[model samples]
Structure formats: C-alpha cells, structure tokens
Target: MTVRLRPTLAALPAYVPGKSVPGSIKLASNENSYGPLPHVLERIAAAAENVNRYPDTNSSELMDALAAKFGIGSDRLVVGCGSVSLCQQLVFATADEGDEVVFGWRSFEAYPIISAIAGATAVKVPLDGQTHDLRAMAAAVTDRTRLVFVCNPNNPTGTAVSGAALLRFLDEVPSDVLVVLDEAYHEFVTDPSVVDGTTLLERYPNVIVLRTFSKAYGLAGLRIGYGIAADPAITMAVRQTQVPFAVTQIAQVAALASLEPAAERQLAERVAEVTAERGRVTAELRNAGYQVPDSEANFVWLTNGPAEAGGIDATAFAAGCAERGLIVRAFADSGVRVTISNPAENDKFVSAAHELRA
Candidate 1:
C-alpha cells in the first residue's frame, strides 16, 4: 500500500520555474545574466578546495560580514540556502496548523507553497493595478494571522509599494504579527520611494528583511541568502528552523568576496546597467502597444491585453516568444515577466515583444 501523505499535498500547486532553452535568449527567470567578478570567482575556486570538510554550520564568517555591513548585531541576522529557504523558515517560525499567512497575490510565487507545506492557510489578496494593495492586505489580517509577506519590488510583477502606503499597512497590522519583507531583488530597485525594509526595523520590532547574493552579486548557482530580523527572538526562531549546514562553504566565501569594497562598487555598476536597461525595455514595450508596468526591479511586467481586441494572453505570448528563440515567464491568463539582461539579450526581447504585440 502507498504510504499516506498529508491531504493538503493534493491541492498544492507546483512551482514552475522559468524555462531555459539551450540556444535561446533566456529572459524567463529574473536572474542576472552578468557573471561574477574575477575576484569572487577566485574566492569560490579557493573555497572548493576544502569541500571534503563540512561547512561551518553557523556560517560564522559570512554572518559576521553581513552583520557588519548592515550595522546590525550578529544576533539579529541569519543565513540560509537562499532567501527562499529563509522564506520557508519564516513560515516555520510563526505559523502553525490552521493559522493564516496573508500576502498579495502575484507577489513571490513561493509564499503559498511554503505556507501550505507548513500546514498554514495561505490567504492571497488580489493586487490592485498589478501592485500590492496594502489596504486590502492589512484588512485581511485577523487574530489567526501569524505571518505576512510583503515582497517589495514583487517578483513576476516587478512592482513595489510606496513607503507611505507600506507604513499605513504596517500601522494596521497587529503588533504580534510577523511581517516579512522579501527583497531578493533589493539591489536592482531604482525607485527612490520604495521603502528600504531595513529602515523599518527600529520602529517595527515584528519586521524581518530578507536579501540575497543571487541577483546582482551573480551568486544564483551558489545559493546563499540572509535575513535580518528586527528582534533577536525572531532571528533565533528562524535559525532554529534552518536545515543543518544548508549554506555551503563555497557560497559563504563567494558571498563574503562579493561584499568586498571593490566588488560592491563593481556590482553596483552592474545593477545600474540593469535598471537603465529596464527603463528602456519598458518604454519600448509600451511604444509597441504592450501594457507594461513601471518596474523597479531588473525585469518588466506586461499585462496580457484583451483577446477580443486581437490581443494575446500570457501563455500565447510566451509561446510566440519561444518560437522566436526567446524565453520569458508567462503567468497564464495574467501577464508576462521579462528579465533585463545585457544589451544584445534585451534587444532580442524587445524585438520579440514588438512582433508579438496585439
């Protein structure tokens, strides 16, 4: 007989990552196409020499570097396999069976999956104008609500909430509820009004800010990310739920190298390039008659136009791009998300957008 699995497993939606075709220009996953700097590569190679040995379970050196970089106490920070792992750990930290975890729909795709795995109910509030509707989300929170995720510069949509709106939402949430600001794309944000989640820590003790080395730092393959909790207790809970030695030595050292002054400056330049390209891409798509959002992250979101107006929905548009040797993420019946890359790759995406425009 087959072993019985949790009944909730049946209804859970599998996470579909961006497609990667060998010969195609990939703008599917919101990944930085620019590779690591030479110095960081050197560090990764050096770290590889000691793979036979176990990684430090605590990732002490890396943790120290991040703590110092952010001017926070070491006790307030915790590292994980990626910010995604921290996302799961946060669910484990505050959520229990039947408790509700509220977040905006069309935000990070992982929120619902993780909440379900933890036996917590996922409460998805629909976005207003392709952006987080903070008022609606805050209103959805109840006493049973244990955790809330605000993916600022949201994934797949590339839209972020203003600081003022976020503040209003925060004021509405109960002080006992945990608010997680997943800023995996923190490095790519160009908007001045998007609240830096870190700055909210002092006033909101329940707040936790997550960041990653995978984006602009070009460390996606290595898998390392971290979170800073406003309260040491929350940090402690996240740490307690972490898988042992999940952060590898190579990832740890690579992240440390990426934080070096020279590396930081170089990475900042790369982010500037992506943001510049993002603006160009959005404008180009709009000019081509696509409904594109003002993106703050290293990607642009295009709403699927009305089918009655000879428009194509997300799936059909993605299929069209695939035929043209370009791969982009398509949220069925919703929109398409195209990652900003180097000039050549981005130009190919823009051309595809024009050809596919309704």
Candidate 2:
C-alpha cells in the first residue's frame, strides 16, 4: 500500500530557484554578484577548522552581534537559516489548520508554500501598480487570519510600498495577527519614502521585521538572516519553532565578522554601487521600451508577461539572455527580475536586451 502523505501537498507548488549556468554572468537569484566581503571570508576560513563539531544551537555570538548593530535588546531577535526559513517558522509559530495567512500574490514565492506546509490557508491580495496593495491585504484578513507577510521592496516586481501606506495598513490589521515585514533586501533599498519596518516596531507590537546577511553582506551561501520583533513573546515563539543548529558555525562567524565597523562600511559602499547600477539599468531598460518598475532594491523588474499590456514573453527574454551568456530570473509568463551587478555585467545584460529586441 502507498504511504499516506498529507493530501493538501498535492496542489502545493514547489519553490523554483533561479538557474545557474557556468561561465555565465548570473543575475537570476538577486544575489550580490560581489561575493562575501574579505573579512567575512576570513572568519569563514577560521571557522572551517571546527566543522567536526556541531554549531552553537543558540547562535549566541551572532545574536549578540546583531543586537549591538541594530541597537536593540537580544531578547527582541531570533536568527534563522535565512529569512526564508524564518518565513516558514513564522507560519509554524502562528498558524494551524483552518487558519489563514495573508500576503501579496507575487511578493515572496515562499509565502504560499510555507502556509500550505503548516496546513494554513493562503490569502493572496493582488498588487496595486506592481506593488503591495496594502489596503487590499488588510481587507483580506479575517478572524482566522493568523499571520501576514509584507515583502517590502517586493520580490520579482521589486516595487515597494510607501511608509504612509504601510502604516495605514498596519493600523487596520488586527493587533493579534502577526504582520511580518520581510525585508530581505533591506540593505539595497535607497528610497527615503519606503517603509523601514524596524522603525515601526515600537508602535506595532504585532509587527516583526525580517533582515538578511545574504544580499548586501555577500553571504548568500551562508544563509543567515534574522527577525526583529517588539514583543518578546513573538521572538520566543519563532525561536521555539527553529531547527536546532540550523545556523552553522561558519555562518555565525561570517555574520558576526560582517558586523565589524570596517566590514559594514565596505558593505555600505557596495550597496551604493549597486544602487547606482540599478538606476542606470532601469533607465536603460525603460529607454529600450520595457515597462520597468521603480525598484528600491538590488534588482530591477521587467513587467513583460502574457497578462500584462504590451508584455513580452519573460521566458523568451530569459532564454535570449541565456544565449548571450547572462542569466536572469524569469517567472513563466509573469515577468523577469534581473539583479543589478557591476557596470560591465549590467551593460552585458542591457546589450542582450537590445539584441533580443532586434
């Protein structure tokens, strides 16, 4: 007889990661094309000597480092394998069967999957102008809504909601329902008007802001991220659901090293470079006649999908880039998300786009 698996998983979609083609300039994963900072690499190398031993289950050193960097109490935080892992933990800690988890439809792909795995219903609100429709999301909440994820500077689309709009949405959401502001791309954001989730923590005890070392810190391979919550109870709940030793020794040391003053300054300089490249790429794409959204993150969005007006087939575009030795993330018929890298890499992708148009 076949072993019985949870029937709900039948319709659940598997997370599709960005493809990697050797020798190609990859902009598919929204990764910092610049790898780990020098000091972080040193820490990782030093920690490699102790791989035989288990990682610290509590990730105490990393936690303390993050606490000091953010100027918050350690009790307000919980480290996870990545912000994506924390996404799952948030669902596990708050939602159960018959409950609902709310988020934007195309925000983070993990939102729906995590909800399904936890046996919670997914409530997805459509974007307003390629950004989170905060009002619609707040309206989607019901008495059974246990968790809400707001992926600021949203994935794929790379559009962010304004601070005022977000605050309004937060005001409308029920205080008991958890609102997780997934800011995995926080370091890449340059917009002054965008909502910095951490700033709202004191005002909304229900809100938790998620940040990651993966992107700007150049530690994507290390998979270290954290959540900041005003309520100690929420932090406790998330920690309780975490897998023991999920953050490895190497990852912890790398993250701690990244918090060093010199390392942080270097990271900031890199972020500035990415931001400048983002503007250049966005302008170039728009001049080339693609409906590119205003991105506050490390990537730019091309809203060319079968359903979008004057939309180009995103898969075709991605294939074209692949042929030109550049890789970008394509969402079937939805659109393409391209990471903003060094000037030369960005120019290469732009040239590919022009070639595709030709």
Q: Each candidate: what lDDT?
A: 0.90, 0.90
- At residue 190, candidate 2 shows an lDDT of 81
Q: What would the TM-scores of all predictions be?
A: 0.98, 0.97
lDDT of predicted model 2: 0.90
Cα lDDT tens digits for candidate 1, 78-119: 999999999999999899999999999888888999999999
Report the alpha-carbon TM-score of model 2 versus the true structure.
0.97
**In model 2, which runs have C-alpha deviations exceeding 4 angstroms?**
305-310
User: What lDDT tens digits, residue by residue, belong to model 2 across residues 119-184?
Assistant: 999998998879989989988999999999999989979898889999999999999999999998
Worst 10 residues of 1 by lDDT: 303-312
Regions more than 4 Å wrong, model 1: 307-311
